[model samples]
Every structure is written in C-alpha cells, then in structure tokens.
Target: MDSFDEAVDSVREAIDRGDNVAVVSDPYGGRDAVADEAEEYTLGVERISFSSVAEADGYEMSFGGQVCVVEGCRYLYTRRVDGFAPVKSFLQTVVESDATFVTTWNSYAWSYAAQATEVDDIFDDVRVPSLSSAEIAELLSSDYDISEFLTDYEEVTADESPSLRERLPFERLRFGIEEASDNVFEKISGMSRGNPGVARAVFESRSWQTDDEPLDLSYDDAFALYVVVSKERVSRDVLRRVVSPDSLETSLRKLSDSGVVGFDGDEVVLRPQQFADAVSYLERRRLVW
Candidate 1:
C-alpha cells in the first residue's frame, strides 16, 4: 500500500477505537500524505484550505467560537499556513473544539509555533512528527525502518523554507513608521506584525474606517496589492489608482476560488493568515510578484 493508504488505515483504527489524533510531519510526508490515506480507508470528508487569516477566522466561527469537533472527517490537511497570528488563532480554535487536526509544512512553520506560547498550546492535543530529507533518505533505504529512523535521528537539520516564513517582501521591504502614509498603516502593521489575520482585517477595513466609503474592495485594489506586495507578476506602475469596483468582485472571486481569500457571494474577506499562507506558497514557487 502507498504511504497515504497506510496512514488512512492507521487513522481508521484509531477512530474505531474512539480515539482523536493529530498528525504532524515533515515536508516530504505531509498532512496530505495522511489525508490521501484517510480518504481511502474511511468515508465522509469535509475539507477546507484556508488561504488568508480572515477565512481562517471565518472557518473557526463556522464551527462556533467554542471548540469544533470534526467527527469522521477522514482528514484535515493545512498546507503552509503561516504568520504567527493566524496560525495561533486557527490552532487555538481547533484545540478548543477538541478536534483532530493533521497539519504539515517545513521546519520554520513549527519553529514559529514553538515560539508562540499561546499559539503552541493549540496543538497540545495533536502529535507532531517530522521527517527531514535525510530521514526520508533513510526511510527509502533497505536497512531503514520507521521505528529505527525515529530513534536514530535528532531534530531535522535542513534549512526551513523561506516561503513558509514571512509572506512577502516585508522581509526585504521593511519601512520605518515614519515611512507609513499615515499612523494607521503602522498601527495595522503593528497589530498584525506576527499575525496575518489582523493585518488582513486592517487592510480591507482601511477604506471603511478612513473614509465614509463602503467596504468595497475593487479588483484594481487587489491587483495593486498583488503586484506591489508580491513584486513578481505585474509591474508596480501597471496598477492605476481608479476607484472602481466593476472588476474588484471578479478578481476577489478568483482569489477566493484559489483559496487565497474568503468569499460569501459578494463580500470578500481576507484571512490575513491564510492569505499569507497562500501568498507564501505562490511566492515560494515564484508564481506571484
């Protein structure tokens, strides 16, 4: 059987015995590896890939503020969900719900979690196991066994993936508070410094709070941010400052479709954390500018 199938069988046995499990693994054998296994081994699946913090929070609320227990949900795989804030919030929500959440990513993702005490506690109920490239090589070797591999290796030694770290050029585009247009961007930045969820809400709400305008984020605005922050795909000058919403909805819909933002019909919500995650993945792959 494939590794994913084996994982599903293992998870099924756990569920049959009325057990809750949280599986964490390395870059190679990630949550999806286990998720594929679960789908083959069991029935019923309710899965959502959050791309922004707003969407992540919405997911949390959908399950209720109190813990949301995902019963018989064959699998839950969170890929590259970054930023200290959104990750922490999502983890806490799942932990409080007492649900089984299987997540996977490179080393840096976990390191950031370990540093966030409150965020780290969210996974207190989940078991996180990592497999580095060296370990993967050992697993592929004829002399290696999963048990022996775990015992022989210490923590992973490979470098954490940068895409899983900061979401954008913010790492390279650090601006002084004085450089901020007004104090609001700075404040919003401060609130979401380590948390994408807060930053997303702040960015989207800027229009509503600053001016008496409605919370209408146009496609032009999104394209602007996409090109400006991403600094990859489209040129910065290509973004013209036009206060039009004609194309905004279509663009937001595309983002939401790709799991970058949250869309409930016309309203567009940016899960700063999840958006950061999606952006991280895209940026890592050089899909965006």
Candidate 2:
C-alpha cells in the first residue's frame, strides 16, 4: 500500500493555497501521518484531541496558548463530533485565528456528522485509504520472528502463500486472531484487517512467541479491549454493562499499562496508536455490528 503521504500532501497543498482542510481517516490510519507532515512545515505543531464535542466548548484558550508559543504554528485536531458544537468550535477556531487550522476525524464518525450537521460547509474533506498488503508484509518482515531474529536472517517470510508472515489479506478479517496457543502470524494478518497500526500492535503483543517464553493474553482480555475501542470513546458505565466486573479492571489495567488504552476519569479510550489493533481484535471476534 502507498504511504498515506498523498492525503498529507493534499492538506499541505491546501494550507499553502490559504485554504483550511479537514481529513477523515480510520482510527489507526492516516491522521497522525498528516500531523507529522504539518509539523515539518512550521515551527511547531499544535496537535489537540477531543473525545467528544462537549470537551471542545472552550478550545479557544487552548488554541490561543499554542499560537502564542509559536507564532503561526500549525494547528491540528482529531475531535470526534457527536453534535454540532465541535463543528462550531472548528469554525470558531479558524475565524478567530487567521492562521491555518486543520482538523482530522474518524471516518465512521465523520459520515455520521455529514448527515446530522452542516459540517460539510466548513472545510474541504478527504478520506484516507487503508495500507496495502505489500506494506503489511514490509512491516512484518522488519524486526520480527524471535526464531528468525536470532538467525542469519533477522526476519524472513515464506516466499509462499499461507506462509503467515509473507501472506496478505491472509484470512477473514472478522474472526478475531487465532489463539496464540496455536498460530501466531495467521492471527496477526487476520485481525489486523489490512491496517498497518493494528498489525504493529499484534506484533508488539508478543503473541507470536512460543510457550517457553510466553506473554499470555486471554480471549476475554482481547474482547474487553475490543469493546472499549469499538468507538472513539466509551463511558465506564457502558463498559460496566458489557465487560464482566471480575475481568474489567484487569483488562483495563493490562491494556493501559501496555499503552494500548487509556482512561479519562470514568471513560475509557483506545490510545491513539492502539485504535487499529482494537478494531482488528473486535472484528475477529465478530463483536462489531
């Protein structure tokens, strides 16, 4: 797959032409790549995130403080819009600052906003694409396979099909990864859902290692993590209704400590990079509707 550079380039081109741009990407897909490009263009990048529109009510001061720190700093946000207020705040931010303002959104969330509000009027929008299988293979072939890590080849994928590491779109993306106790790369390719970030998470979960040197992650933990990340943000109460109490705290703690998820008081969210992984996991479990 192509690097998400084209979407990043479009935003850069818009800003150069003095037009603000809005980008919609999958949770683990393209937003940060755009942010990274923006950072390269200015003194600093003011990256902000909001779990919901209500949190955006008074973003002026937040945006202002950053502008003051670095004049003409690139301003970027990834706010999940549940109402019109965030769109209003986005306009308000651009209106208040003649400086360029760019916003990123989750693809599913953006589609919902398009129908519910007049967000279409505010900025030019683009939806980023998922990574290609070639890209996934390239990533997997790097610094993986402990057995291979110690061999002459740091990482090697079979030149053959169904050779887990070398395969792409390897299996049905919906069946949550296969058990770590049995197959590893099959699970990685399946659950990752053609998304780079999710594949990276599966790689880091260390599920590929054999029993002699194990990092055990249970199906419950995987599914619980999935519930928290199926959307941008989920309330603790909602999680309580879904996740078993006996398992909730443990799952939350493991995900948090592993940098896969985070807590905002009573709310739980998938950490930025971990979002794709959670999606892959949930899809595999058929827990997503």
Give the best candidate by TM-score: 2
Candidate 2 local lDDT, 1-289, one digit each (tens): 3447777777778777766566776666647667667657765456665554235544554554222111101111222333345456656656667666666766655555555565557667766755534445566667565354333122223342334433325434332333221344444544555456666766777543522211235776776675555345666655665567788888778777766778888777766544545554555666453
RMSD of each: 17.3, 7.9
Poorest 10 consecutive residues by lDDT, candidate 2: 67-76
Any idea what lDDT model 1 has? 0.37
Candidate 1 per-residue lDDT, tens place, 50-145, comes to: 433234433543432111223211111122223334555555555555434433332233433455434344432232232222323233333323
Please count the clashing residue pairs in each candidate, in the order shown. Answer: 24, 5
The runs of at least 3 residues in candidate 1 whose Cα sits more than 4 Å from the true structure, single-residue gaps closed, are: 1-10, 13-20, 52-83, 96-99, 118-289
TM-score of each model, in listed order = 0.32, 0.57
